[model samples]
Target chain A: MRGLGTRTVLYQQNVAASLGLYNNDLKSVDILRETGPITAGELSKITGLATGSVTALIDRLEKVGYVRRANDPNDRRRVILVPEYEYKEEVGNTYRPLHQSMHELASSYTDEDLDLITQFIGKASAILEEQIKQLNVKKSKSSS
Target chain B: MRGLGTRTVLYQQNVAASLGLYNNDLKSVDILRETGPITAGELSKITGLATGSVTALIDRLEKVGYVRRANDPNDRRRVILVPEYEYKEEVGNTYRPLHQSMHELASSYTDEDLDLITQFIGKASAILEEQIKQLNVKKSKSSS
Candidate 1:
């Protein structure tokens, strides 16, 4: 399982390199795609980056047209980071092969077995998220 | 599955940060652990880093006592990168909690179900590995 995790990471880093983007930058875009428009503070929390670093990350991403900063309508004091759909569409092409392969693999499995796998994964993901939260807490405590 | 993969990468990056090491440095250690003693050139290919960068990466890991450069016994002209046991043990401790939790999770599954998950993961990993190889090839071609 650990070896599988490491390979997954390596594959992601390679994908980022292929698109001429840093891994963290691609990760930020992914976060935005998942969460929709969020404040820079939220991005820092989710990504475990310093607030100032998040600012710089957003700047670089915006310059590359992957993301844009917008004023929060409800709270003008806050800036929201939004992913650019066009860039997402372009990068989505790079992942087509991977998705296609995974889809084929999934189809080979019985629906009942797929459900079991999905349930297992979802629970495992929850466990990992909890652990990640704990790690982030430790990180912030030490840094301060 | 993609989300799980991203979380796995994020968790690893956070672990590296908490240990006062960069993600790439930790990844180098992981590669060394898996490949046994490999050459710097092989590390570069595996990591998609430039040869010069690989040299610096090895130097950093060496300074931190996580890796050592030794003369290859079979080929005196080449050097091999070896992972230090002590550091692996220390790093292994950091992953202990995660491993424990995963073990517990596995214990809940029946043998047949566990076998299915393992089989699915093995096939999925192979697919990802193939795609990664193609991406690396593209990256090298463009860079060259």
Candidate 2:
């Protein structure tokens, strides 16, 4: 049971550290990872991060050669973000070891067990997010 | 498949944000979460972070009322770190929504499909880690 939590943390830390980025950096990555070539404003909206913060984040990632901004052909005011293909490959390569370890670990568990864990993690994440939202609501109401 | 990755990122972000901590800050919480109370030195070893860094982390956590350090009566030089009881409730309460969601999601997936997805992710994570490790080794060797 405890191994479950540790594995989750290790998985996260290993992925972020391998990419030489912080968790927030990964959040930015996720926005791009899920939807390819999005504008900065779009990413900001999706992530709920400020435009200024997104700019800084994009700057940092660009400096590291992980991402780049291109002028939107249709809209001059908008700049689209495209992950550097080479960078994605680089990041993907870095994840190979962890991926292999996870595969081996999963092999030990039955399909039923794997399904249980997946559903468990998925539901658990949703529950956690809802609770956080509720707490924020409570805090706001209290302050008001 | 993509949804799983997104879910993982969401959980990672929620965990970080709820704790008001970043990647490095959560290292201690991770240690405590996985192994319960542990000696500072042991934590340093497990985390691969410097002892000084661990000590500083402990200090910051102590200042924030998140963790407490206790002297080991048998070993005066050793300090054991424990998470405050409040954190247990906080973590559990925060994760409740996620757990419930996961339970529902599990019910939707066939045991075989869940196994396949879990296996895939597990393999992917291991492969990624291995690739990164090899890259690091190559970099080190080249530099030398």
Candidate 3:
């Protein structure tokens, strides 16, 4: 489990380096890509980055053409940060080999094996999300 | 799988925030703890951080009492970084509940189920590592 976690991080670090971006920046791009257009404030809240820091992150991403900022259609006062979905091609290509390998590995397992694996992973992921939520609540409380 | 990866990153980020350290700094401590006493240069090599950046990282970690720097006895010119393993208590306590929960989750499964899960995780981790190595190689080549 520990090895899996460490390698997961190392993989992102390498990918970030190859793209000439900080790990946080690359991660922000990912979040944007996953969530579609969202306000900078929402991004700050989700990422736990301060207002200034989140702005800087957006600036970096925008400069690289990975993201764009536009006015919210319903609210003139709000700015929506848009992910340039096309940017995924570069990042996706880098991950293709690992995806292929993982796909091959899963195909080799029986249905029962996959079901068990999926159950474990699903439970484990929930536990992680729970812990993260608890920590975030604690942090916000303390900061408040 | 992607949720697991993102959550893993968030878990570490929250832990780092709670510990008053950068995510990268906390991860550096993890590596130092795992690898034992290693020189700054060795850390630089392992993390792919520039020497000056790593020096700053060591300084931040040392300031917070999570790391110590010592001169190698056999080679006076080398400075060895020793993690204050005692610091793990604070970090460990935060993770203890999750660890306990995961232990229970695992114990609920049969040995066969555990075996299959382990095998799958091991193979997936290797693929991630292999992809990381390829990225690192590609990065170094481009930089050179």
Candidate 4:
């Protein structure tokens, strides 16, 4: 449990540091990076953040010039978020050290070991997400 | 780059969501989780956060009862951080989802594909970290 927790924390910190952004700022960047040009409403739903929070996140991101909100061409009522510029180069540069360390670490492992670790991490992540969803549902049900 | 960024963001978000902690809060949690009962100074060095920043972070974690500061048994001048009782359970739940997801995703991939992606990510992360370090060194040199 501690190991998983540590991994999760490092993963976030490393990613955020690499992007030259804080954690909250990274959320918007992440949504745009993954889903691409998503509506604020959709972002709120997908991220499970409050609408107000999403709006504020978008506001901060826009202020930093990392993101822009444009009206969806097909749906004028919807505003879609996009990255101000492609972040590939900047982000790629940020993770170089961790990647190098991982390479060295992996080199010490056999193929089976690497596979087992990867599989373990992946499964663990999915279970965490599912549990979170269940927790959220329980909270909502109790509140209602 | 996109794949790396997305994966990194997801990993962080999943972990944070599990602990019911935010990204910034998770930094301290992660350090404590990894090194176990470390001094604030050690955390600052390991996290690359300013000492002042680490202090504030520790304050927040302490307020939440997630972590505590104890006088070092060997060195009275230093304070060591210890996780509270629930920390393990909290951390354990965080990785459960990720592990499940990895198991499913891995089944779809050939061993070679997994190796390739892992190697690519490893190389890319190293390159990125190196670039950032170089930039930091350049800045420090210029300032001096």
What is the C-alpha lDDT profile of model 1 across B107-144, one tens digit per residue?
99999999999898888888987888888888778879
Best by lDDT: 1
By summed lDDT, the worst window of 10 consecutive residues in model 1 chain B runs over B85-94
Residue-by-residue lDDT tens digits, candidate 2, B84-136: 73456666666566666666766687887666656555555445445444554
As a whole number from 0 to 100, the lDDT of residue B88 in candidate 1 is 69
Model 3: per-residue Cα lDDT over A1-144, one tens digit each: 867876787788878888788888887787787778999988887677778999998898889888999998989898999888465678778778888888999999889788888888889988987887788788889999
Q: Best candidate, TM-score-wise?
A: 1
lDDT of 3 by residue, B4-122 (tens): 77767778888888878888798888788778999999887767677898999999999888899999888999889999955667888877877898899999988977888998999
Report per-candidate DockQ. 0.72, 0.28, 0.65, 0.19
Off by over 4 Å in 3: A70-79, B70-79
What ordering of candidates by lDDT runs from best to worst?
1, 3, 2, 4
* Each prediction's whole-model lDDT (CA): 0.85, 0.64, 0.83, 0.63
- lDDT by residue for model 4 (A77-126), tens: 87789876455676656556656666776777779766765665565455
Write down the DockQ of candidate 2. 0.28
Q: Total backbone clashes of model 3?
A: 0
**Deviation in Å, model 3, residue A99 alpha carbon:** 2.0
